[model samples]
Target: MAVGRPRTFDCDVALDHAMEVFWRHGYEGATIAQLTEAMGINPPSLYAAFGSKEGLLKAALDRYTERRAAWMEEVLSAPTAREVAERMLMGVAEKQTNPANPPGCLLVQGGIACGTGSASVPFELAARRAQTEEQLRDRFARAKEEGDLKPSADPAALARYVSAVSVGMGVMASSGADREALAQVAAVAIKAIEEQSAR
Candidate 1:
């Protein structure tokens, strides 16, 4: 129950535009007309290609996580839990301030100004964030099993702490915090992990 595909527009290119639009405006604020306008596609074409506004948002969010959060996956490869934490913290400090990309993070920004109309939007955004935090928790749990972290260390708490700091960093970045400030914040976060992991 949709329309024909356009010969002139590329899905990937339009998705990139939609990602920026969604990044600038939170999930609830992004309108279908705005999305189609940014994608240079009509309503039926958009529906045919993406199913609905929410579907298009899901696509844009996937693209954003793949492209922007690649560093998170990379950090998970570090040899130690401390290394993983530090690398992830530092990476956020660097990327959140990149002039080339939109400030803050798509994962965190999506729910910042979330409203009641599209209840699923906040749930989707929160789920993505929770998924990342769960990764951190798993990483820390493994570290504990491997004796890198203390046997008594609560992986969930450590993961939540790091996640909270990361979210704060995103908020600060969106509020115009510079790279140096974010770096200082990252240092503080990494230092806390270092102090605890040393135990």
Candidate 2:
């Protein structure tokens, strides 16, 4: 029997690798050659699996959304909203400061690049932002219901604030902000929440 080539294609792994490349360099900045090289596959193989770079990015965005939602679920379900908020901020802080991973959020970096270059990507990014904001608002609403947040505070507003901070942190991380600085910024948010929740 003739020996066949070892199986090297794993769609999941390839998509993840592609995602990271797009995450680091954004869509327009990432060339097909770069993606293929990073994915360890030929152009034909990548195109066959992912259709095109845009298709691959959309799929990757879906994966990221699902993964982030799962993580948010865990954070939101904490015993107290204070714990939830702190943990959420801590997670962001760690991600920002972690040298092993990409410096900033893939969506935010891509959105910035895309908004200036293409019309469609901005809408795509907006939809993603809306989804994320909804998820965050749900968590904040739960916290409010549990009396972990001030009765007078608006869950939507708080969620928006948290989201804003997260985006800022992503930018700061890309700009080489230190862990201590991230933690300090996170602490400010946490403190504000604590004060309100205490009311």
Candidate 3:
């Protein structure tokens, strides 16, 4: 059998566009027309490629998590676990409040206002959010074993604290909080980590 030709539309490019739509408008609020228009594909083509609006959103979410989450890896690469968290908080503050992109996080904005039919959307987002915190926890746990973190520190609790601050910053950014305000929020969260620092 002969190999078929590749898709004319670039799935990654289209998905990036779709992500912006859902990022700006919550899953419940983003209309199919808006999505199709933003993706530069007709309704039939959109359905054929993505199955449905939910499917398209799923693909978009996957792209967002995979690509955007790369930043976390960099933040996690700091010399110490405390630096990892501080970098994560400050980076989030910077990115969330960036004027070039939509304010707030795609992981957060996509899940808010999700109807009962869209319940899985929020759960999916929650899982992704939890996954990042889990990563942080593992890093902190290693730090404790390596003597970078105080033995008395609770890795899980610290992870939860950072996750909470990150989520709060997203919500505040969505509500029009300025970069300086978010920076202050990040600073407050980092202070707790600083107090826990071995140095």
Candidate 4:
């Protein structure tokens, strides 16, 4: 008997599906069956294409990282540090509050769950966070150069602080915080960044 030709999977589409499944259910919660089903592929095909569930997740994260960079580019293009921070914080707040997105950042959610459970997860999570921080720092640095930020502002520290607040808001959203609560939290965070930049 001869083996039939296998159907080809669209790598990008499959990864997007995987990302959504993992984002919805989380790492420990999402099963291989769920991933494969959502991706419209079988176990053998999924494994053949991506090696393992973890491998697929890593690919999904890479996709997400690229998407984030694109978004950051838009956010950082604002005229002032306050505007940039507001743009990002408001965007996050909207997502966090939206019933559609369900308030979880994929990387942040995965990091929180996997960071403590596995050896490599924590490192990957840290790296992801570092990447985000670096982008924010760059934004802040540029704002300072344009006099949008005060001369005394510390871009590195501001970056760390803003990222922490953003991640914290995601956790809050996961914990059942409503849109009003998230908006309040976002406002406070953005205000703090602005006030500090002024000094």
Candidate 5:
């Protein structure tokens, strides 16, 4: 029996293109035509490789998370809780405003809005965001235990605040905020974290 033909396109390259399309346009906003065009593959190939649009998104998100792992590790390993916040906020400002990639984060822009058919998209993105928040919270808790943060400081609250600020910065970047503006926002956030440490 004759075997099927080989896939001509590189899966990694295709996924990267698909991810950028998804990042620029939310779940409901991205059309199959757009994804296929960006991936340089036909609809059948997409279905055969990834199963469905949602499946492709899951794969893309996994790729995105993998790319972020190193940065997250470095941020969490900061010598103090304040440094962690500083690194996180400042890093987000720079990343979101980088000219090389799309404005706004994939995690933030990928699922901010979805129709009933794609309702699970938001929850998927939320879970990922919550995971990041949990990591920061655990790091802050460790900092408090080590006396790097004041005894009165709330690790969970600080983590949530930082996460909220990061999310806000992504939104601002998507809305055309420049690096300088985001840097100023990050500066204010770092000052707040520093004040908490002094309390």
Candidate 6:
């Protein structure tokens, strides 16, 4: 029996590069050739390490989510529900426009335009997004219990509203909207949250 050679490339670094390629070109748009070139790994290495292109994408999504865990925690830990909305929307504004990263979000851009062959990709991304909305709903429910939001406020609705705005901001960013535009969008979202909480 013969042993295969050890991988020379760093998996994390390669995944990060693959993530950027997916983020920039989307799932259907990104080719294996592009991913391999960006990741600095050959096709055989990618297949051996990730099993398949979808596998690599799943791994990249996991890495992207893990990188944002801290920020998500901070947003959820805000002192008030309004502040939570403020932090979330404004944070997205900053993140989506950051010069260092590709515009928009991986979860949003990665599967937005998937065709029939890649249909499952959109659902996978949607499930991740729904998880975010669920988290927001739970947080807002807690805020209502704490009197941070009015008793009449619907936590689920507020969560959906915020989630929708956040997703729309990502689309806007992908469409070349600047930070200032997103900031204005966030401001309006926060105001809506405030009003909704009051009512």
Each prediction's TM-score versus the true structure: 0.90, 0.87, 0.95, 0.88, 0.96, 0.96
**Candidates ranked by lDDT:** 6, 5, 3, 1, 4, 2
lDDT of 5 by residue, 100-190 (tens): 8899899999997798988999999999999999999999999899888899999999999999999999999999999999999999999
lDDT of 5: 0.93
Candidate 1, superposed: residue stretches over 4 Å from native: 1-8
What would the per-residue lDDT of candidate 3 be over residues 95-164, giving only the tens digit for each residue?
A: 9988887899988998999888888999888998999999999988988888888879999999999999
Q: Worst lDDT window (10 residues) for model 4?
A: 110-119
Where does model 5 exceed 4 Å of error? Answer: 1-5
- lDDT on C-alpha atoms for all candidate structures: 0.84, 0.79, 0.89, 0.80, 0.93, 0.94
Q: Candidate 1 residues 55-145, lDDT tens each?
A: 9889988887777467777888787888988898888889889998789988877766766667788788778888889989999888888
Q: Write the number of the candidate with greater lDDT, choosing between 2 and 6.
A: 6
The reply for model 4, stretches above 4 Å from the true place, is 1-7, 115-117
lDDT of candidate 4 over 162-194, digit per residue (tens): 888888878888888876787788798888888
Residue-level lDDT for 194 in candidate 4: 80
Question: For each predicted model, how many residue pairs clash, with residues at least 3 apart or on different chains?
Answer: 0, 0, 0, 0, 0, 0
Between which residue pairs do clashes occur in model 3? none
Local error of candidate 6 at residue 30 (angstroms)? 0.3
**C-alpha lDDT of residue 190 in model 4:** 85
Residue 108's lDDT within candidate 6 is 96
